[model samples]
Target: MTKEQPIGFIDSGVGGLTVVKEAMKQLPNEHILYLGDTARCPYGPRPAEQVIEYTFEMANFLMEQHIKMLVIACNTATAVALEAIRAALPIPVVGVILPGARAAVKATKTQQVGIIGTIGTVKSQSYYQALKAKQQEITVTSLACPKFVPIVESNQFQTAVAKKIVAQTLQPLVHKQLDTLILGCTHYPLLRPLIQNMMGDGVTLIDSGAETVSEVSVLLDYFQLANPNPLKKRAIFYTTGSTALFDEIATQWLPITRAQSKKIHLGGTTNEI
Candidate 1:
């Protein structure tokens, strides 16, 4: 709507910060407003109706903040609710799936692509659908990594235990000899090193979060909403979970000075949060 307005980002948990981190690096002049539904996180196992409801609530909340654009940073939410929100909202809305799919398609030499996401996302076959919709001949393999979200949410990423967990959960995909692997969940990018190492050097790890920000830039220009002022950039993070934990992980993961987080509730009839 206006240059003063910030771009909104929503995820199941702190995983969305991966996108916010990239936005910070790419669009330093623009501010960010992030919301994470940590209280009811790991949307991978939830029903599509529930995921849609939660995504609507978060998007509605972000809309109330006057954001010029919204990015659905959660893969599960993007799979289930992206179209509905985009069709209903006036502002431009971006999702991580398409960008990742495009990268996977371009990165793969053998047309073999692997995707790892939450159960809900995998079950929905959103990545397969998106990739196929782009190029029907592309081969897509998908696996559900339900434990990845909880591990990252608890700030256990990059540890020996985390590495082992990732390797075990992703073992099935390893044998597929996938030339490109889509880190379908936003949280999965934090474990990039372990995933890359386990999947080996030949497999290119596609971070959907990192890719989504490029689309953000495109939309900003298309909408003529790109912020030109570089002096007053800011980012505000809110979680339906613990602010302390979100603050801690965000600080560790992002390149910003510090993450300012507060606890907020969503999905009520009134403005309860």
Candidate 2:
């Protein structure tokens, strides 16, 4: 593979843009190709087999474009599909969980950590496993905020109603005595303000996507895949859902100018990129 090849990233929805935003900042010279399966979003509640199928579908599509590396930006997908995809693909693969877990381990002073994510992610206990692997004495409290993805995907994360929902959903963890909380899903960072307000001032919120990009940087260097020269167009976004909504959210969250998000259909031999 050549250095100019774009790194590929796949997510359940626009939530993965959170990771893309960080990649832009941390790896400024690399081109990025991102896909969001917004058409079948909230993969959190779906069966593991289905999530795996969909994740590979997205990963395979990016592989066709000859990406130098693959970042599984969805927590649910990473929990279920990271290993299989890594074994099957030729390129390097990175997932969000381990990095986020490591960050939480580093930030926690009380050895107590809280995790909030989608149902699938919570059910998989991926964060709990990763955190314990890092620090056996760490205390973890995990919750599934299934309502969150819809709010972010619908572009309602900043609304008053969104705040109410976040407050209500996070009430269970208020007294958990956590000094650090890992926003286990990429989408959760968009609601960072509300989550921080609900969790109060003592708790540090870990954006897993940001941490994942750090690993991606290291991997690029280790694999000798860092792009020496950037392309004129730094990023291309694709979604299985509405391109307009994807473009709108990308504009607000990304550092790029005139973010062009296109539509992509999975399970087909041909697609529009």
Candidate 3:
């Protein structure tokens, strides 16, 4: 493994751009190769087995790029595939869930933590397991916001419709009066403003993307994989769906100049690379 090799990140779609944005800020010198399986996105609604397979394909592709480390940027994929990827890959594999759980545990003063993620993620109960593993006494309430991802992908983040959807999805948790809400899905952060407006000022909205980046910093330092260069590094993005759509959404949500997204078919062994 070369010291200057780029770190790899994978997501279901443009959602992972949130994680990449955080990485760019936290590790300015580290190069990154991001792959978004947008063609088969909304992994939230997919079966667990399929999500696992898709995540493996993406992880294997990134591994082929000789990435120094792998970051599973999708909460759904992280829930179903992180451990499997970690066991199979030689490099360090980091996911958004544990870091988010840790942050939520520390951020919540009331011991009531609310998590909103995709169906796959919420169903997996990864956050609940992780949070409990850290502090068994903490109360966890999880909700699946399937519509939230598409809303953000369409770039309807702060619109009235977006707020309405957020309010509807979050209404169930309001009575719980959570002190901290973990935006478990990477895409959820894009809806943070609307979510915050509905959840009120007392609740701390934890961005998993940001939390994951901090964890990545610690891991890179511990493993001596942190890029030593002082100059800013560039990031490359690839998508398994339409490049134009990915580019549009990415440019809107991230600090990307032009998304170098390309369409790829993930059906055979050739797709593994």
TM-score for each model = 0.96, 0.98, 0.96
Native-vs-model 2 lDDT?
0.93
lDDT (Cα, tens digit) per residue for candidate 1, span 1-273: 688799999999989998888998899999899999999988989999999999999999989889899999999999999999999999999999999998888788888889999999899989998999988888889899998999999999968899999889988988897899999999998889989999999999999876799999988888789999984647988889898899999999988777878778887842545
Q: Give the alpha-carbon lDDT of every model.
A: 0.90, 0.93, 0.89
In candidate 2, residue 207 scores what lDDT? 96
**Model 2 stretches astray by more than 4 angstroms:** 268-270
Could you give candidate 2's per-residue lDDT for residues 1-273 as a string of tens digits?
999999999999998899999999999999999999999998999999999999999999999889999999999999999999999999999999999998998899999999999999999999999999899999999999999999999999999999999999999999989999999999999999999999998999999887899999999999899998856888988889999988888999988777778888986653775
The better candidate by lDDT, 1 or 3, is 1
Candidate numbers sorted by TM-score from highest down: 2, 1, 3
Residue 235 of model 3 has an lDDT of 82
TM-score of 3: 0.96
Residue 37 in candidate 1, Cα distance off native in Å: 0.7
Least well predicted 10-residue stretch by lDDT in candidate 2: 264-273
Total residue pair clashes for candidate 2: 0
How far off is residue 214 in model 2, in Å? 0.7
